[model samples]
Target: MANVAAILGDVVEGDRIFSPTSLHLPEFLPAEAVVYPTTEAELAAVMACAHQHRWRVVPTGSGSKLAWGGIGAGVDLIVSTARLNQVIDHAVGDMTLTAQAGAKLADLAPLLAQHNQFLAVDPAYPDRATLGGIVATADTGSLRQRYGGLRDMLIGISFVRYDGQVAKAGGRVVKNVAGYDLMKLLTGSYGTLGVIAQLTFRLYPRQEASKTVVATGTADAVAALAGELRRSPLTPVSFDLLSPALANALGYGEQFAVLARFQSIAAGVDEQVQALSALVGASLTHQILGDDEDENIWAAAGKALFPQPEAAGQTVLAKVGLPSDRAIAWLAQLPSGSLARIHASSGLGTVRWAATTAEDVEKLRFTVADLSRAGVEGTSGYLTLLEAPLSLKQSVDVWGYGGNALSVMKALKAQFDPGNSLSPGRFVGGL
Candidate 1:
């Protein structure tokens, strides 16, 4: 195996080579490697070299979400898919599209909608995020409320293992569940599990009509409404709770936005709308928002996660999951003095929080770590975004805690790429 400089050639510009980490200014990157491959053949060549030498490999999509997982323990050669972007297939009638990992969502969304259908699982940063990155990171935003997250929408995936073997799982048939759901197994596993090269997902008809009903209030009140809205027959794509202040940022003065998304034949909307009204509190009244309105309010509230005062200056952002009811109250336990922003699924279960600085992240680490040791804290599971300072990497326990499934995760990683060459310490349990 050649030295990193020799093997990567021009792709390895000494010292000048940069990573997606700086975009968010993350704290740590354990390995020191970068490799850009223009084709699958080049990817294979690079993988062959890394595998032979037992070098940790980090495969990248758009790098739009490098902050999603723990910092790469150390990158031996950043096998970037930036150059491998291509739409291999767009089977409209089949409602299936296939593309290289580096293909951007901005590129895919409009294309999918051309056939009156769309890839429903999209985050706010659709323009910069790639299909593979989003899946590897398992990211989805407000729209996820309606269509479900990537794990549910993903139908098939093809990737390169650490040992350079190309493998695939799942199939294009939207309804088929022929075997173990390897595609889902990889979802939310971070990049440690596999390097997603191409993916196929079931799409939904582009929403014909949608609306957001802003319901403003306190956290407890919002929690109650969140439950009510979720249980109602309104069929909301999602109902997100915004802080009174967050609501104001979106011009909703102290009111939490209960964005109830709807999709159906035109006539039923009136019935759903009426049903929602009956379910909400008497104190709450909605300001009906249309496409532009729905777009502006939630866009600011949903994707505005990064700017959250708590998470803004920090180098990490984490998405956490717990029983739906207790999410709001958990915010009280965030690192002291940390500026953070949070979004809870209508059920109060899944939440995403972005912490501002590396120091604040340390606060988060200990907080979650303590809870883990004690066992049965409010935060059941979490995904780290060590996208901050390198120093914080050592001080803080980045991946807060784990469940009984971690042993299984490590075993699977070993089984898939026994070399331990793919995203070594970047995933949960340092797989």
Candidate 2:
């Protein structure tokens, strides 16, 4: 038998010191590693031991989003994905690819390139983020403008539940909505539900033609142009609004930018470009560019959002979802003294905001109440902290109280992971 103590060296010190997988990840510390298994069988065995000993487990990929949720209340063991890296299958005819949980996205990109296909949802740090981590965090990223998100790409999953069950859901094909949409259910469950072992995602054909439109304006002007383009029939693949502060972070300095991407057949791409150029004419500074340009610009834009924890500050990064029109109103509601930005994906209905404050719990509660009073119902407009104080973990509700869905979630969790051994107290409705 392998000694647990001997298995992990320097990962734990005197049973106290620990390491988070993301460099300078925020609001999380001393997250010790327990075991990293290469296959589902090994992962299942680890889960059994954890269930038996009642050890709390937290699964991680590249650790890109370690601070997005509150620190786990009892993280006794961390299941890192460093060992389980592989692209198990890439079925072009099937328009899907099955990958090991630990496979770095960068590694898979080239393989997909050979088949003239790509994962639609591209997070900022694709080269580093593991496939399983992307599914766990639901890291949609900027490409979501055209392809939607992980919630859309992920059609199947394989995971080790807390009860030692190696579970699988969905399949390699697109038509199976068969039983429960457990695949979608687990996308953003924050690992509180299970440790994902493998993933199968829908793929998109590589675009034959692609271009980016960069419109420059002040915060208000950029928001206006973003609004106009959103209403127009010309469909851009991605839309990004960089707040002045965030623009500074991206080094554009004084030039808050609006980015719209369009790609398709060469003729269709040209038509969209002509229509878009007409919209931003004279009213803004515009740049017409190609795919290489799109990659360079977005790489700069998206990378700016994933800075290290210290750079993110002791502030809270919150994701706000509201109707697209009311989306701009948030710039006024947030603390004037704070650093904040907005990126609206596919109109204003699904928007993400990032901000920093000294006291996130109080600030977040106030924002929730403010949006709720304004009738941000159904959603009640909750914000998950991007980075926060550990003390805030006990005080702030990362995902606030839900209504009926919360009950269903609890039951589902109970059915799958009765012990709450995975990501204790770190997910929505305290799952």
Candidate 3:
């Protein structure tokens, strides 16, 4: 601790690091100290010293999503990038931007808005979500239907390895390289492999006009409408199927609903809306929201999906991936009162439920597995517990491990963090 403090000279105590909502309690994972490094060089030096001492270190960026993954064991130091928040560059003409890992999306959004451009991500806790934190979690929102996830937006990354060595991957422009795809490798690694210092992303110009078309019907009917929208010529920025509870929470009537967003020139958006309405006909109750109404609806929708200052019982946030054709069937299997927010275009969704006892959590876990396997298409599905109580997390693997890539992930972790000093036991298969 003395050696690291001497090198970094910005040491802080680790008290008050954990929030009440934190999945992992600070009392369980006692840290020797917390250090903040402003510059990449200082960060590397601190990491190298920790590596030399063989001390476990956990990296943090804004601490927005710190309660995301399994709590890493034996952590001795908490290296924070809070002071590393800076917008390094914004090549507006090139439609690319670069910023330090700790740079908050809230701060960067306005800066990019000046140029009529923005990064295409709408992670929960956006006001505090850092660039590195979003990449580490690979978090996304409704924008995913149009711009894709973090892996798609990321173009370059600069990170410091466990041994204090700096590594680079990709470049400013989108071009293929000869070696490993570090951009994809570390995007959702949960800071187990390396500590991201800076990142570059492809930016998109903000749309001129946006509107949402929402329609309600039975679960099966909504599912069919989702398929129709996917097959139709109309282009939507986001297509989501909301559960009745979630729909009501988002300002819609308490009924199954299909919500789609269209953004473009006024005429283009209007055309798409009319075509969509005609396709659905009078079979379902439908409405078109103008600019102000659209914004309000989407804001309420965001709250429904990721309620601000989440209520005490809303402890679980799980991401499920499966074919859209099976979404309705799969959703029917969930326990009553579970709120689901699903992406209709992509077969991805999030389910939030409250469980009182550990046994109840275990039961829900099995339900997820059974429903995923029950797919009629004979295709596999995935359920990852993005957030949960520490007790619930201890009983089952948060990330169900069935893929063949576990060995490769182990190899990469061993190679990147030979001393097992970086975020030990917080990744897939406890890599």
Best-fitting candidate, scored by lDDT: 3
User: Between the candidate structures 1 and 2, which one is better when assessed by lDDT?
Assistant: 2
For all predicted structures, in order, the TM-scores are 0.84, 0.86, 0.91
Q: Judge candidate 1 at residue 93 and give its lDDT.
A: 80
Ranking by TM-score: 3, 2, 1
Reference-based lDDT, residue 365, model 2:
49
What's the residue-level lDDT of 110 in candidate 1? 72
How many residue pairs in model 2 have overlapping backbones? 4
Off by more than 4 A, model 2: 1-3, 6-32, 218-220, 251-256, 310-315, 332-341, 345-379, 400-404
> Which model is ahead, 1 or 3, in terms of TM-score?
3
Candidate 3 collision pairs: none
Tens-place lDDT digits, model 1, residues 133-228: 788777776666767778888988888777677778888778877777888988877778667778888877766676666666666666687777
Q: How close is candidate 3 to the true structure, as a TM-score?
A: 0.91
Give per-residue CA lDDT, model 2, range 1-431, as digits (tens).
13343444323333321344433444354545446666677777777777777777788776767666766676767776667898888889999999888898888888899989998876646667888888887778767777887888888888888866888888989877866788888898888888898999999999899888877766567767777887888877877665555555545565566767888999999999889888884657878878677678777665555555456554555555544544455544544433344556432222233333336445654565566557445555555554556765656666555446878888988877787778887777667
- lDDT per model vs. reference: 0.63, 0.69, 0.78
Best by TM-score: 3
Check candidate 2 and list the clashing pairs.
237-261, 315-357, 317-386, 324-348
Over the stretch 26-50, how does candidate 3's per-residue lDDT look in tens digits? 4435566667677888788878877
